[model samples]
Target chain A: MFPFRVPGAAPIRPHGRAADEVGRLRRPFAVVVYLQSRDPAHVKAVERRTMDKPTHLIEFETMLLGRHLQLSAPRLRRNNQSLDRSAYTLLSRIRMEGPMSIGQLSEAFGLDASTLNRQTAAMLRAGLVERIPDPEGGIARKFRITEEGGRGLDAERSANISGLEKVMAAWEPEEVAAFAAYLKRLNTDIENLDGRPWPRP
Target chain B: MFPFRVPGAAPIRPHGRAADEVGRLRRPFAVVVYLQSRDPAHVKAVERRTMDKPTHLIEFETMLLGRHLQLSAPRLRRNNQSLDRSAYTLLSRIRMEGPMSIGQLSEAFGLDASTLNRQTAAMLRAGLVERIPDPEGGIARKFRITEEGGRGLDAERSANISGLEKVMAAWEPEEVAAFAAYLKRLNTDIENLDGRPWPRP
Candidate 1:
């Protein structure tokens, strides 16, 4: 049986003649048949089909990620670097892409200008980013990552990756690769649907 | 070339004599060699090693997820249901696990009791949850999801799931499963490291 039921498929009859037959055959032949059918390719296909129909898992992932962020918010600061995870991320973005106008940042991050303004303001106060004339000669000023900000971002990134490495230490290398590929793909698709959050440098 | 560069490795000599050699190899042989070397198992291992060493991708995932949540937050309300994503998730927990005391909710969510208190108070004001006597004879009043809350939750869940489906429409079923599984594992590990939020029913 598949791990997840198909979304609108007929409900499995729990106590019918079919069920009785399944129960009776459960010990030997059924086990043999199940094992025989579960070759690597077959198992992969089945797992794929099971994941295709339901939105529950995706929704659950979103909820869990949100909660994880909330749970970790307080601990985001480290070693006198007062920037939170979002701030650190912003700094990293600027570092990677060079200076960007607030409007451009808002577009890339899918956030309101006001929210970005507040966040950037706080970052400015901390000297993590500074406004500079747009190199492209645009009217709007651009924000660039400061040297201090670069160090802070490096610290936070190292810490986060170290934490992930520990959590994933027991996983197979293949599993880690699949997970990373899938996550990257998911983000790519999301960016396609919305707007690209991180333009390649 | 791998999708991600290995951390601490020397940068790809993009403009060196080696670059000229690689460029001279041209399309067919170079493409064939690249494809052959990217066997599923080999690629998976490479990806795993890359992810293990770099915090950039992990940090990017975190930032993307956080931004996605913020982007989706304003759309959570519909009709007369005004619950935010966090509130909807909280109500769903109550619905799934039965009535829970504020203290229990706090512990489960890894949040301060005062935060839960304020959130629950808002839920009460919205009539999404109601105070009830704890069935287990606990002194603190427990919170139960109201019928209206259930309906609101259903609406919000459907909307969120629909959005995810659209965003993920182009993804392979295998990709979806891998992403979901990885996300779940990540959350479980995070919970273990910190404190479990949302006990199993």
Candidate 2:
């Protein structure tokens, strides 16, 4: 997002090293950075070698990825990305699953009703979703996507893709597709375990 | 997470089809839910078919992944995972990079100094990290992970992996490794593009 550069930073080590070094570091290395400042200072970080399983690596990477995506929103916002995180998520959900009541949303997302209420309230204010009588004649009122929501979702999703494209600019198309497929599988599996499966497009 | 089941939810479709169907739907399908409650009510939703590239799919999946990770903290917390989100994140970063000043953390994370200060203050209060003099004689003081912080990060990370293991219990080991590798690659690419490359083992 930012074209930040440390004047004297070391090149990044290639991958496969960490993944390949699984079970290689029973007593993980303790990093001691030589934090410097001003005149071409490099915030040196040690290469962490963990005696962790591949799943551990996945967990750690996802944690960092979550942070990246959170920080990524403001960067994209300047590029005219309108949808906030919740809106993108809810709109995407509604797009995939059609109309949903608070109960169904709660069940699908594993989120409490109050949280969904707050999110949907904001979405309502934004005109992203409209209250509709449950099409199947259920007691709980359902939320259906308005044209604005769909349009906003489409735009925001497109912007996100554009941003990702830039991030993955150097990656092979096959690699990109494979990574995307893996992520989808990973999430679907998590959803399955949570009993809150997100509908796929 | 909740093992929530609607009395009548539809079966999941196998993957590969969506990834293969790129650019197939210019105007995505409009989902219609058959939301019913009580007596075997099915929250039936139509499948969405988007005219998007593979990059778009990645974007959508990653957004969902962010949600999964956020929601995952609570599930893991119940399993004796003690570190809160910020604590776990900060400790992990500290562990990986060793000690870091607020200025260094701000530069690496793209977060403001105020946010870093607040996070460090919380870490200090929680006994997770401590302020230490800059090793390289830099002006700004750095925060180092405490023994408690390291121990907590390890435990929390272990729990996270265990949770992921349960989530991916059915997948083969090779698949797990490939997913992890892809995830690392994706994050590194993001970090590289953002000019804040995370140090790997």
Candidate 3:
């Protein structure tokens, strides 16, 4: 017995049956089938089957990552630095790559120019980054990480690292390496899909 | 030359200098040291060294996960479902586990009661879930997923899974399974750290 009715699992057979009648009849049946099954063993078996599917595994990973972000966002800030995840990431990127134009940052992050403009403008107001002449003498100015921004980024990064370290302390080094490689490959694929692949540093 | 400055790489030496002077002097030195090294070969070496350390690997994974969520949140919604990541997750949980109380959800999610209340209330107003008498005849009422909720959850889940599948398409089945297992383990460890492990289905 399936624990939950798989949505749209039933084919609507219109053979000698009115389409409207099929729709009307199947709706209540679907709901009933979905609500009636509450057996734990069935749920477990269904969950196990779902977990075995690659698509389900991917969905579960996405959901887990989103949940972890929501759960940890509040605790991620350090020393009154209210940098959201995006801000923290932007600062870290700028700090590592030195000054970069908004276009460059946009391309690197796979975000649009308008989004980067708003984010960088906010960062500028917060003194996280400063607009400066492009080091390569380009037409557009570049944004450079400020000292305060570096400190905030470092503090937050360290705090997050410490938290992750504690969580992963039991894992072997090889396990960590394999996970990281997979994650990097995943992100790279995501970036490629968005057509804004970040260049290898 | 490091692709990123390994934050907190400087050894804390309080041997002979005034602590304040050392603090003031080391600040610039650290920044300069971090920025001036731009040799690609050196960067690769440093990256390899960093990857070998489990703490750094964990930090990289955390940062990548955070970045991925920030990037994907906008695309995860379906039509006007308008459910944030947390709401979608909550609805999915209810749909899977049948009716559950706010307290139970809070405990399972490792979130506070007030947060779950606000989330569930929004879900209730949105008709994604309804308050129901506990099936087990407990004092606390439970939340049940509405038919509409299940539909929305299915839509969003399918969209996310499609995206993930595209990302993982080139990966072997075994690779996907290994990555999924690792991710599950990591999430389990994180939940355990918070002392609110979700019961396995």
Docking class of 2: acceptable
Write the candidate numbers in order of decreasing lDDT: 2, 3, 1
Pairs that clash in candidate 2: none
Compared with the true structure, what per-residue lDDT tens digits does model 1 show for residues B54-165?
3345556766667667564343324434468679779978888999998888877877888898999999999899999998898999999999899888888777777778
Q: Show what share of the native A-B interface contacts model 2 retains.
A: 0.65
Give a tens-digit lDDT track for model 3, residues A1-201. Answer: 333345646522222333343333233434343234456565344334333335577567657766776575454334444567788888878887889998888778767999999999999999888999988889999999999999889887777776676778788666877887888888777767666554443
**Deviating ranges (above 4 Å) for candidate 1:** A1-52, A73-82, B1-56, B72-82, B195-197
- TM-score, chain B, model 1, is 0.69
lDDT tens readout by residue for model 1, A18-86: 433333322333333333453656634533433344456878776877877655544433444445857
For each candidate in the order shown, give its overall lDDT on alpha carbons.
0.66, 0.69, 0.67
Which candidate comes out best when scored by lDDT? 2
Steric clash count of candidate 3: 1
Q: Compute the interface RMSD for each candidate structure.
A: 5.3, 4.1, 7.6
Residue pairs in collision within model 1: B108-B197
For candidate 3, the per-residue lDDT at A6 reads 58
Worst 10 residues of 2 chain A by lDDT: A30-39
* Model 2 spans > 4 angstroms off: A1-53, A73-80, B1-53, B76-82, B135-137
Model 1's DockQ score: 0.27
